[model samples]
Structures are given as C-alpha cells and as structure tokens.
Target: MKKIKLIFSFILVLLVAISCTVEGINEDTALLGTESSANLNKIFDISTDNSGKVTITPTADGAVSFKVEYGHGTTSSVTVQPGASTTHVYPEGKYTVKITATSISGATTEQTFPLDVVFRAPENLAVTLNKSIHNLKVKAKADYAKSYLVYFGDVPNEVGTPLATDGEVSHDYAVAGTYNVKVVALSGGVAKTEKTTATIIYNAYGLPITYELATQNYGIGGTFGGISTAVVANPFPTGLNTSATVWKYTKTTGAETWSGSYSPLDSPLDFATGNKIKLLLYATEVGKSLNVELEWAVGGTPANGVAVLKVANTVANSWQELVFDFSTIAAIPANAKFTQLVFRYDDSAKGSGEVIYIDNIRLTN
Candidate 1:
C-alpha cells in the first residue's frame, strides 16, 4: 500500500506541472496576437535629372516585411524587408500606391497613397523661319525639349505638324498674304514652350517687265497729265512684236506737253548685267519724239535721274524695236537705286488724242 500511494503522488505532480506549462504558452500567444501593426508611413525621394525616378522607403511600428503595388500599370509588386527601400521610374502623371505591411504575429495593415509626378517646362526656346516666295521652312530648338509641333496658320483649324529637334518642316501657301507661324516645344510631358512669328508671301518683280505672268502685280498707271495706261492684248501682234500682251498709252486731247505714264518696279534697276533697255514701239504717225526716263521713288534729283530720247519714229503704223542706251548715266553713285520708269511721247507738242503701243521691255547688253 505505501508503494502504491507514492507512485500516485508522483503522477499527480507531473500532470499539474504539464497543465501550468500549457497555460503559460497560451497566455504568451494571446499577447502576441493582440499587438497589431500601427503607425505605417512612407518616404518618397524624387530625382531632379528629369528621368522620372522615385525612391520609396516604408516604415511601421510592428512591420517585419512589406508588399508594394506601384499602381502605375501591370508592373509586378515588390517585396521589401524592414529598413529597405525600392525604386521605380514613372512618366508624368498621377497614381495611387498601395502598401501592405505584415507583422511578426501574422497580422497585416494596408494603406493607399496618392502620388503626383510632374515634369518641368522646356526653356530658352528659339525658332527659325525662312521664306522663299510662297514656300516657308521652319526649325526649332530648346532646352529639355524632345519634340516640336508647327502650325502654318494658313488654313482654318489646322493640325500641327510634327518636327524633330534636328529636323525641318516646309509648307507651301496657296495665296499671297501674311501668315502667323507658331512653334511649340514639348518635354514628353504636360509642360511645353511656344513661339509665334509673322511671315509674308508674295510674287516680287525684279527685271525684264514682260507682263506675261498672270499672278504678277505690274503696278502700271498714268502719272501727272496723262489720261491712262494699262496692260492690254496686243492690238497688232505681228512682225517685231508677236507677244500676247502689250502696254497701251493714251495721250488725251489738249493734255500737258510733259504728260507721261509710269510703272513701279519691285526693286531698283540693276545695271551691272546690262546698260541698255530695249522695247518694241508702235505709232500712228512718223517723226514723233519719244522719251524713256528712270527716277527714284523717294529722294531723287536731276543728278541721279537718267533719260533717253528718240528724236523721231522711223516707222508709222508698224512695230519697231527701239534701244535706249543708259551707259552715260552708269557713272552715277553705285548705291543709287531707281524704282520708277516714265514714258513720254511728243514732249514738245500738246497731245492730239494719240495712242501708242509698247511691248517686250527688257534689258540687254
């Protein structure tokens, strides 16, 4: 009986000790489960090199690991441990970032953050425009610009043409007028730089007044005491003058003795190539004097003006070629530019309602 009691007492003591150990383990587990993650925060560092690079560091009170969802696209999530950071490159836009932190006790906390990434505007924008008649060429350059857009401003609701930094764009206008040209520089983001300028398109007359171009503005008119002057079809297009058009001069009855007609040229006469002006003339009567003169539109004097007079007409009622030698006046100032051409007929007598036809006015050696 004594041996049996001692064995029972030993078994009861072992049971009690095992029960206390199990209770102590349960209490420790409950305390750990109650301690949840808190105070989750993040730090973001953006690069200044315009590369759109961002470094992110996350922290929490009880976090041991993290799962980061960048929320920009289909990019895979990143797994980061405590005291570590991750980096990502993003375009210029806004995004929402999701962060999931896991605690040591298997508890998780999640939060969403709003992120905005903006780019800087381009700087020091410079644009170059060149015009040749009706054609225009454009080019542009700027700091931090990736591309360019050009608006020719000739059409209504025009779409911008794309251009590269090292490239040029060309446009041909249909009509002659002034147009506004705009160039925009882009930085691959919302920021941009723009510039605007004006360009003129017209057909400029230089030498050899032919009156053949339909689009050319000849600036033909009568000056002082003449009746009128105009470009008309060749009344007698044969022999020396077979051209389709001719300049007609009408000397009204009883007009002044110095009555004349004039035409303006786009630029001053250039006598370097030739020193003679040749034209075809038609008259109703013989022995009529004709004069051709050159005068500056502004600041002109007798010293700089030049004239050539034909003593009498050799042919009557027919086309005759006449040459006016300007070599005598070539010694005038080299910079003297004459912009106007004057024609006078029978300067010594009053007009008797005489009409004259002229054609093929050109410069020759």
Candidate 2:
C-alpha cells in the first residue's frame, strides 16, 4: 500500500512540473522585430494652407509617439494614447511627416509621408507719390498673406523669403521721368502664386525748362502780326499800322515759339516741387495803361479754360511791371500742368482811342 501511495505522489509532482514549464515558455514571447504587428497600427496624414502653416494628423490612438521630418535635419514629435489623433503645425516648405506607435505587448511601429507648405504671391502691385519732387511711395498686398516680397525692375524676385505680413515698401526718385516696377509673392509650397508689374511716371514743378513766349499784335514798336494758334503766320507782319494796336505775349523761354494762336508751345519744362510760378508784364508806353487782362491754361487750352489774372488799373505806359504768382492764382486748379497763356488790353475807358502796346510777358522760375 505504501508503494502505491508514493507512485501516486510522484505522478502528481510530474504533472505540476509539466504545467510550470509550458506556462514559462509561453511568457518568453519574442519582440516583433518587424514593424508589421496587430499591436501597433501607425498612419499619418498631412495638409497645408500654403500660407506658412501646415497641419499633421496620425491614426493609432493608444500611447502613440509622433514626429515630423522636413528638410535639413528638422524633426518634431508628440504622443497620443489609444484610439485617438494628434496635430502639428509648421511654416511654408516641403516636409515628410512621421508617426510611431507602441502597444502594451512591448512591440512598436512607424509610418511616413510627404507634406507641402507654402504661400501665394502678391498681385496688382502699384506706386504713388505725394508730390513729383517731394515724396513717392510704393505698396502691394498679397491674396493670402498680410506681408509681401518687393522688387524693382522689369521682372520680379523675392528679396528674402517673402515677409509674413508687411508686403508694402517705398522708394524716392531723385529726378523725374518714367520707370517700371514689379513685385512677387509665394504661397502653398507651390500653389496659387503670382507676380505683378506696372509703369511709373514722375514730373516735377518749378524747374528751369524750355518754354514758349507769346505776345499780342507785336507791341507799339513791334509789328502788327495776327496769330491764331491754329495758323502759323510766316514772316510776321514786318510793318506796324503806325496806329497803336493791342498786343500780348506768353511767359516762355527760347526762340522756337511761333506767334500762331493755336500752335502748342514748347514742351513744358518741369519745375522742382513747391517752386512758385511768377508772371512779369509791362506797358509798351509810359503813363499809358490799357486795362491789362491775363489768363492761364494747362496743356494748351483755349483763352478761358485756364486761371485768369487780370488787372483793370490805368497805367503809365512807362513800363509798369505787374507781377502775378501763378502758384496762388484763384482760377487755376491745383496739380494741373500748364499749357497756354493769353493777354488782352482795352484803353477806350482811359479815353485813349490809341491802341495799347504790351511787352515783357513771362512765366519764370
């Protein structure tokens, strides 16, 4: 009986040992060296507005380790647990987003994809100036951003990675004339970008430029030349009709000017900004004033369109010089270019049937 009991005990011991060995072998599980595993399912998605901001999202919720790899050793990381997602933002550029996940089973996995970030370029860039010779500034705005990249030339270039929000810039012109301008903008790594160009013309006032000088019926000592800007009276009247005739002259410079009433004067000589325009007039005879009247025209208008500066004062023909400041003329509009000059004289009221003569009419610096 004792032998039988011992055999039963030995059998029990053997069964216990087998159970322990099987349990330990199962617990000694090998690490899933390959990324493929049900414990870890990693996924990544990237998107960008192209305006310098990019977003990245990953699938695989439980304790996920996230990261993004872009150009030049640039990488970022974050982690989210079980059945969830995470986000990341970046500036404009190309990128590779990566996400990693690990499970309670002690196994890990990872995935990667491309990402693009960028901004749109500027458009309809233009220029403006306060005064031709005083101040001029340039400005531009982009469709998707507050700032811009500025360039001056027939073509456009980004000065330094386009500015984030201040796309506006300015420059001053030393002399007056015309110029070409351009601008560029960047967006979406490579989407919706544009460049713009325009022409810029500058003119200054109060400069010493060539001008036309006109006069009415050549003065008393002059000739009785009738002039219509439309008709050029070749060989102006060589002889005066002995009797006095009303005369007029435009305030101009140089000898190219012809006494035709409709002919356009020499091209306007630009003046420096803030320069004042003065008119000098005198009577042909002493103590003989002919109620002088003056009118101003811009870009060659007829007798009345321009600002008119007239004085009805009786004068001593003895060279009465009247000074008129065109810059302050009441009838002349501001910012308009000068074109024509006119003069008329009436001596009948002064009881002098004698025609009046005028001379020394000028528009000068």
The best candidate in terms of lDDT: 1
RMSD of each candidate relative to the true structure = 13.2, 14.1
Pairs in clash, predicted candidate 1: none
lDDT of 2 by residue, 1-365 (tens): 99999999999999999999988776665433333334334444444234343434444544334333433244445565555565555566666666565655545666666665545544443333222332345555555544555554433452533444543445565544444544445453444344544444334322222222221112112211232221122122223212122234321222122212222223342222332433323344444222222224455432453454445433443334455455655544444454333333332222222333333334554
CA lDDT, candidate 2, residue 161: 31
Local accuracy by lDDT, each model: 0.80, 0.41
C-alpha lDDT (0 to 100) for residue 224 of candidate 1: 71
Residue 312 error, candidate 2, Å: 5.5
What are the per-residue Cα lDDT tens digits for candidate 1 across 1-365? 99999999999999999999999999999998877679988887876545678888888998999888888886689989989999998888898888889999988999988888887787899999986657889999888787899999999999999999889999999987778899999887899899999776656555677777754555543477855678899989888888899888888898889888776766557665676788889998888878888766344633434445454679999999888877765455444456777788998888889999888788777
Off by over 4 Å in 1: 1-30, 47-53, 89-92, 130-134, 144-146, 175-177, 187-190, 201-362
lDDT, residue 310, candidate 2: 42
